[model samples]
Target: MIEYGFRLPSSHDNRPLKFEEFERHLDKTILVSATPGKYDYEKTDKKNIVEQVIRPTGLVDPIVEIQETKGQIDDLIKRLNVVIKNGHRGLITTLTKNSAEKLTEFLVEANFKVKYLHSDIDTLERIDILRDLRLGVIDVIVGINLLREGLDLPEVAFIGILDADKQGFLRSTTALIQTIGRAARNVEGYVVMYADKITDAMAAALSETERRRNIQIAHNLKHGITPQSIVKAVKDIAQHRSTKLKGGKKSDATKVPKEERLRLLAEMEAQMDLASQNFEFEKAAELRDEIERLQAEWGL
Candidate 1:
């Protein structure tokens, strides 16, 4: 049997993973990310690396502007107002959850339609919050590390990165690049770094962004094309809620015959393993949770 999987190079604590042990089990590997992390650079073959620079939406990369961090929050608010007036949206990433919450409050007081997202927010609310942001119910969204990746916001015209000079995992070159990519789907995309001094991370991010921007500009000019923002419709959360309810209506594990219950448990465990091997951690975690729930029902 063959197995394949993927993981972020860093752990939840922001330390590098011990890949020596992991590499022992694999014959081949492929590393993928919008901004490859340090481990990718150190371990992967540079010649084998694949670069995907052209976005299907034909959106040009954002213009990055460095601003003083002395009055970062106020500075972001002033700029976001212009984005809102233009019927576009803004995203702001701070360094901490407290900073995110504080900024959200400040934006609310300023009468801007805004919301803050973080690990503390419940899963259901996170879905609703993102849906609302896309639907224009909220003009601005604030987040910390969560805003760095897997955020698909096509209406985002501006990204305000606070504490951009702070050196660490949050300000790493990879993190900065991922955050900047959030604005890449919009025609009017732009990134504003609230920093007094440019760090190595910022410089690398700027250089890469410029490279991609130039390529995109050349492509647009050659094709006689105009950049356009993507418009993705918001999906209703109620459909997911209904699906959850239907899936929860399974037969009680304790009520099933012993042999059948064991068979079901075995099947689920196999699926969980398959999910893990396929690098679908979220699906694997869900299956693990379901297994535990079934075990509890069976009084195991």
Candidate 2:
């Protein structure tokens, strides 16, 4: 499955792979994404294109609004306060990892429970951070591109896109639409683009969102349906098996005898299987990497 084909180039070692490479290998292929790229369009006929504008849950797209960048942080704080008071969470996206962390720090100083997520964070820790947000342990999460796709946080009602006028990969139409979609899981979903001027990407994203929203609204009205926020049971994978070395202490896997190390590996393999079965792909990937590392270290 070529899911999130936009990021396929950076998916492995930052090297871009030509679409033909996959085309040669498979007789039939399905490219899935909300915003399919040019390659996807070229490969598939216009008649074959399928659109799923209305969600199965009847949730409509979030409302998109552009706000002046002046004092954007202050405005975000005020908005987040209201969302938090209503027992929901917020997401803030920045242009870079440094900006995300800095914004997270500023929010913390303002007494908002917050954290930042980016490529630099460990995979397992990232899972815990998301769980904390879902459990209301944190009110806001500042992130870069990591907050876009594959995240199902129904608690997030508000999304603040900072510096949205700047046109680049992160601010492109596809990126903006995906980021704005983060709030669509909630009935009160809303998006604020903090931009002084609207870019071409911003205009397209806004227009597309409005179109989808209208379709959804029409469908819901016809069916007499009210959108409800998705309720997902938060599963704690880290609680079952933690890979972190505690308090600068050596790992048990390293200090144990060869037989004990083998046993640990077996246990980790079992946990990885469970994580995969539970649809925790990120956690399963982390466990697989850790297992490889231990196998090489212990010569098991």
lDDT of 1 by residue, 64-142 (tens): 9999978777788788899999888998888888888988998999999999977766544666676787788999988
lDDT of 2 at 32: 88
Error of 1 at 50 (Å): 2.8
> What lDDT does candidate 2 reach at residue 57?
87
lDDT of 2: 0.83
Q: Give the lDDT of residue 22 in candidate 1.
A: 65
Give lDDT per model, in order. 0.79, 0.83
Model 2 C-alpha lDDT per residue in residues 1-300, reported as the tens digit of each score: 237666665455655557777567887777787678998899899998999888878899999988899989899999999999999999999998788888988999999999897766654566778889999998888987765566789999999999999979999989998999989999998999999998999999999999999999999999998888898887655533354322223355556888888888999999977675443756776677678667755667
**What's the TM-score of each model vs. the native?**
0.74, 0.76
lDDT of 2 at 27: 78
